[model samples]
Target: MRFTWAQRLTIAAAIAVAPMSAAHAWNESGHRIVARIAWDELTRPQQVFASELLVRHPRFAEDFAARMPPDIAARAADDPERQRWVFMHAAIWPDLLKAEGKRLSERIAALPAGAEKTELERRLADVKRYDNATWHYDNKPILIDPYALPPAAPPGAKPIGVQQALPNALRELDDRNLPAERRAVALAWVLHLLGDSHQPLHAVSLFSARHLPQGDLGGNVFFVVKPRPADPTPVRLHAVWDDMLGTDPKLEAATKRQIVAAFPRSRLKQELAEPADPPAVEAMVNLWLDESYRAADTSVYDANLRAALLAPLPAGATSALPVALDRRYLPAALPVARRRAALAGYRLADCIRRAESRSRP
Candidate 1:
């Protein structure tokens, strides 16, 4: 069946499972896909770095440790902080878990008919390297949406872009360089920041119901909906979005499948073909930022931004801003997170592919 432009847009947006919170959390499925892609293209050292960075699941983390060089493991083990860091890194990113499943299978496939654990361990470790030299902290402001109009300040207030905090963090990274061994850890920090920056609650400000009562501390102090359905209790709004970040992938996937099944093949094809490169990740980041800006630009989202804004807001709550707030148009934001994850994974793979291919010749 053919869908109208509005229908198609709505369908695509709905695939994402919006209405969810925007707090930062690890996205495992996304992490897995990315690791799988990166593992397929990257050599040993690169795979190790990428694998460690991707956090699809707990088993994958164990697999990573199992595959690491004994010497590197000993060094990591000796340093409790380093060992803990690796484990924490795995806990945060979901893609690594996804890749672990495939990473093990690939190894098993390459072995001789009766290859033993010793040979497998040797091959895996031979490819994995513990190089701290390759990573660096980039403090440069990676602008989410350079194109969006800057947010206006209230009568006497100063104007600030929603991307404020995370960009500042990134900028700091670019200001200093790290020695090679420490580079991987540095990358992890920036990666976390980038992910955090994309969350709308983290990106925007909130305030009281009326009379400009009080400012919400980036949603930290503002009381929004409570986590429980039966209670009218309140909690910080920021936490809501953060929790939504990784709430349920099975539900997210089910929603996406339903939406895509109805999606127009032509348009879906076009979207898939439009751009899938590293720059695309940058662009999508910008797009999400722009959408946030648009939502916050006026008292509310313009018709263009209305969909994104209303999609996530509580039902029946009117926007303080001028933009229309239609309850019927709410779209789930999970799909957006999923796509972002995929793009991040693909972009990471692309980066590693270029590096690995260069080493080949």
Candidate 2:
């Protein structure tokens, strides 16, 4: 059913980003770029404060230091380069928790009961507390069939999603009464989810009577194939958009410098949200989600792609054949993704500066 909110954002638009244990919102590289953009804009005081919070995070050694490159970890704790490296790590930390949790579970399952399994369980429990799949996308559903019944869930049993969690993360970070550790957890979430809010699919999902009765799970279920030279199996539509900027997992200094230079902050402008209260906080976050929804409606799902997705596959056909995008899709959609990532960085900076500029670690 149609959402009643002014921007039509319901509690949850599509399924969890990718079963909660996997983060498909943005590639690790993309999230790093977003974080770098914000780090560049922060004043020295803010940078120190932000970096201090990351240090206070409960998993600092396990999640941050252990995974950090030796060259970076060798720098002084407050070294600007080291801080920049951690900022990128913090932005994708939530996703890392999920990946680690999944790995822990697999290792535990494979091992016979022993000390190793017990330790893994403990780690998994810690990871589980932070691995929330829905936090990645607070989607607003869009109807593919104009007359289809509106999505079923609503006021009844609300879906836990970024729509609610993101604001809470802000409030947690801003609440000086809380311990630094709690705020540190909030810091990682803010870094990751702000970029997620800008992803078009994370903001909107398609619903239809026959084809997508339960929504496209924010494009996770919507498959398409790119024109590859060889074997090209259908890939999740969500994935194609996630890697629009670039997919190399490494966050090299040179590449980071290149992306920050390429996007150049010119086409990105979003209202900076300085949330004063809970409701106000929601409104602020919704502004980003709404902008993303507009992009998804106006651009990503062109008429041809929509037609194929809104109808069921013919007898035994596949999305590879029917939903293949024309070569123009990437060239056209890439800029939109890039601009949004850049804007996410800008908003993330504005968000931190407005929310924590006055607070001291």
Candidate 3:
């Protein structure tokens, strides 16, 4: 039986709400690039519709408008430009929630049992419940050894992985019966997770007999040194991929424009040529995950770099030693990362279009 996008999305969402922890995929700049690309592709009417929905977000006033940079906030603009600004920033809302949730956790822990503490506790619960940081990646461990298979989840364990989360967000986005505020939050997650799913590191975890028996937590546990001389210190493998596009938060606007200009138009044209039907969309997501898994195994975890950087594992060691990426690794991986980002944008736009079409009267 063929499953409609709505049905698959429903199942995915139901599975994801069970609580599983994972890392965020692309950094803010990378997510912004995907958002900007998708935004540029959307029709004016579609953009307006999306912006209207976003404004319905419960915290839009405080989190978006009031928190806008002084210059933009002073203008008090509510035109399409202002709407687009809000829409683009929505892509990063999950990340923002993570920061807010952390501080809230600290505050809640410090507060005594009083009215103020009770109120803070309630808000903290909401933030934790809605925080999508863990929803960004699937921790399905990819065993490096070709002969070995990945470990199965324990019979009773329910880990809501990224593969499950994307469809859940999509289902939420398409549920017109739901409040616009709820749908808007889902839309933000859809945008963010689409970008996350395309990042190779986010889709797969490395497993080896000597090191990662369970998994590397999608490279979170696998530290790697930056190739740059100035920043030789070890960083998470996942973080390096997250910042592949660029790291400066202030540079998002310019970087968005630069990426748009530099994006291979032919490739983008090829990807957008045909949108996947509802039944096929989940398969498309799975396909993207598989492709990313292959990349992580072949390129990101190439043997040469592993040999150069990783120290010899001690007998009975449970983890691989942190390793430095070769100078050539970054240069080699950058193009692949850029291509994936561009493809994510095109695919996201397609998903948005499909959802809009299905929701139409």
Global local distance difference test of model 3: 0.73
TM-score, prediction 3: 0.84
lDDT of 1: 0.38
Candidate 3 per-residue C-alpha lDDT over 149-189 given as tens digits, one digit per residue, 9 for 90 to 100: 56677898676767888888888888778888888888888
Off by over 4 Å in 2: 1-23, 154-156, 228-231, 249-279, 310-322
TM-score of 2: 0.85
Q: What is the C-alpha RMSD, rounded to one decimal, of candidate 3?
A: 9.5
Best by lDDT: 2
lDDT of 1 at 200: 47
* lDDT values for all models: 0.38, 0.76, 0.73
RMSD of each: 16.3, 7.2, 9.5
Candidate 2 collision pairs: 1-150, 1-151
lDDT of 2: 0.76
lDDT (C-alpha) at residue 221 in model 1: 40
Ranking by TM-score: 2, 3, 1
